[model samples]
Target: MAYRGRFAPSPSGPLHAGSLVAALASWLDARAHGGAWLVRIEDVDRPRNVPGADEEILRQLAACGLVPDRPPTWQSQREALYQAALDRLVREGKAYPCACSRRDIALALFAQGRERTRHGELVYPGTCRAGLHGQEARAWRLRVPEGVVPWTDRRVGVHLQNVAEEVGDFVLKRADGLFAYQLAVVVDDADQGITHVVRGEDLVDNTPRQILLQRALGVPTPQYLHAPLVLGPNGEKLSKQNGAAAVEVAQPAAALAAAARVLGITVDPRVAVPELLAQAVRAWGARYP
Candidate 1:
């Protein structure tokens, strides 16, 4: 397959320094391989989305000379595709409806002498795998298989996760009548023909669930390269929820150069955005190749 990569950003807020790092890394990866780079607005989580945030994100990227090769895609507008995928999974017996609320899951895990993972997520106890009993369905979950799921990351090398043990049957569709990120992202990447995924290290844990979804949906899995995360002053991952400020795109070259440094690339910040990106791309190709 041809090299095709994407930078999918949620519209919860404008692009910050941390988000810029991800965007720049994905753009450089695509350009380094002489591939097409695309953008997708991950606004599927409706409640968190800020009005006009998507437009502002696009503006930030444009100011930094990281334009997508094609018109950007919006996840909110692709409900039909996600519904079709969920329906197929339900039909194949690879997915089932669950009536377990967060409390129900906690109680069940407690009864089974199990505790939440270090990440504070309860490894769901498959309470509804057999049947929902008399309970009404509130969500849909994939029936993850046993054994280790092994995959290689371009930057991080090998990794293995047993989804059945670690994550259990994760949600495909949430109780709020929205498709989960794992499901929507998998479907979109397959639909968009994304052959490569370059994002921040924080999302590395999500790769296993996405890989499981791709297999269940019979779609091709993309190569992954998780760029280093940009940390806040408090030493935590910089994020919108953590009050990371929006990047100043007025000085696009400086913004891009700062983000490039996080990825271990040095470029002349005095140059224009286009020239700075060109220099970064050459440096990226040398490093990533």
Candidate 2:
């Protein structure tokens, strides 16, 4: 099969060092294997989206010389596809309505002393999994099977998850009327004919859920490689919410060098954008092991 990969970014903020690392990694992976590198704007969550973030991200990508092979796809415009996938899951009885509010679920988990979980999120208690009728279900969750789903992550080595224990039935559509990332990503990947998924290691845990959904929805499972994360100076995830993920507005070259360093490349600190990208891609492709 042809190799196809993508750099999917949510337009909640500008591209930070961590995000640039992910984008560069995905771009190198696709180009190294002679594959098509596509870009996808994951703007499904309208509430968190910042104004002008999408166009700004596009400009940043162009500035970095990572123009996509095709016009970028926006998840906001693909509601029909996500809805169809959700309906199929519902019809197959592989998904059900979930009425539990986030607060209620959190309190219940706390009451049960299930505060710590493998996925770091609540391992939903399957509260509405059985015999749940629409009663204004605020969300819909895909039912995870009882057995183990195993896949080898290209960068992270072997990975295994027992869905029922790790992530219980996961949300497909939020009660807030937006499709969850799992559902949207699977549908988009299948629709775009993507064959390889290169992303940050943080999403490694989500691969099983996505694979299960792909099978249930009759889509092909793509190969996955979860690259190492780029932590901030505090050794924590650099996120806009935390203010540690911000990019230096004055110098994108510095940001590119920082990203390259995070990816383990020895890059010249003052190279031009094109030269820097060429060096980074060649170094990454030849040395990524």
Candidate 3:
């Protein structure tokens, strides 16, 4: 199959340095394999979206010469497709309605005297799996089977996770009736024919969840590459939630070079944006291709 990769960013905020690194790596990897690179705005979480952030992100990517191979896809506009997949999963008995709220889950765990998992995620105790009785469904969750999902990462080597044991049954749609990121991304990647996924290491844990969804939905799981993270001065992951500064587009060359350096690509400070990106592309092709 021809290689296809993407940079899917949530429009909750502008592209910060950390997100820019993921974008650059995705773009460079696509270029290295002589494949198509696409962009997708993950705006499904409408409540958190910053007005005009999507357009600003595109402008910044353009300024860095990391243009998409085609027009971008927006998750907010792809709800029908996600719903179709969820419906299929429901029909196949792979997913079921969930009525448990966060508080309900906490109380159940507390009553059982069970501590939260090391990952700090509240493992759903399958409260509504058998039946919801007369309660209305607040969300839908996929049933994870007991087995280890194993995949090798291009950057980090082999990895493994038992979806059922670790993730339990995960939600496919939220209580607000919004398609969950796990479901939306799986459907979108398969629809876009994304063959490789190059992203930040922060998402590495989510990979197994996505893989399980892909299998349950009968879609191919893409190859994975997780780039090193950019940390804040306090050694936390640089993210919008942490108030990381947005990448400065005023000095495109400098910003692009800084991002390139983070990915281990060096460009002459004197080089303009275009040339700097070209050099970085060549380096990336040699290193990653």
The top-ranked prediction according to TM-score is: 1
Q: Per-prediction TM-score, please?
A: 0.99, 0.91, 0.97
Q: lDDT tens string, model 1, 72-152?
A: 999999989999999999999999999999999999988988866637778989999999899999999999999899999
Q: What ranges in model 2 sit over 4 Å off?
A: 103-120, 245-253
Per-residue CA lDDT of model 2 for 1-289, tens digit only, reads 8989999999999887778888888998888788899999999999989999998888888777778999999999999999998998899999988889878788877898887666467788788987556566789999888899999887777888888887888999998898999999999999999999988888887899999999889899998988778776788877766674546536767777877787788777687877777777788788753
lDDT of each: 0.95, 0.85, 0.91
Q: Rank the candidates by TM-score, best first.
A: 1, 3, 2
lDDT of 1: 0.95
Error of 1 at 48 (Å): 0.4
Residue 121 lDDT, candidate 2, scale 0-100: 76
Task: Tell how far residue 51 is off in model 1, in angstroms.
Answer: 0.2
Q: Which whole-number lDDT from 0 to 100 does residue 160 have in model 1?
A: 97
Higher TM-score: candidate 1 or 2?
1
Steric overlap count per candidate: 0, 1, 0
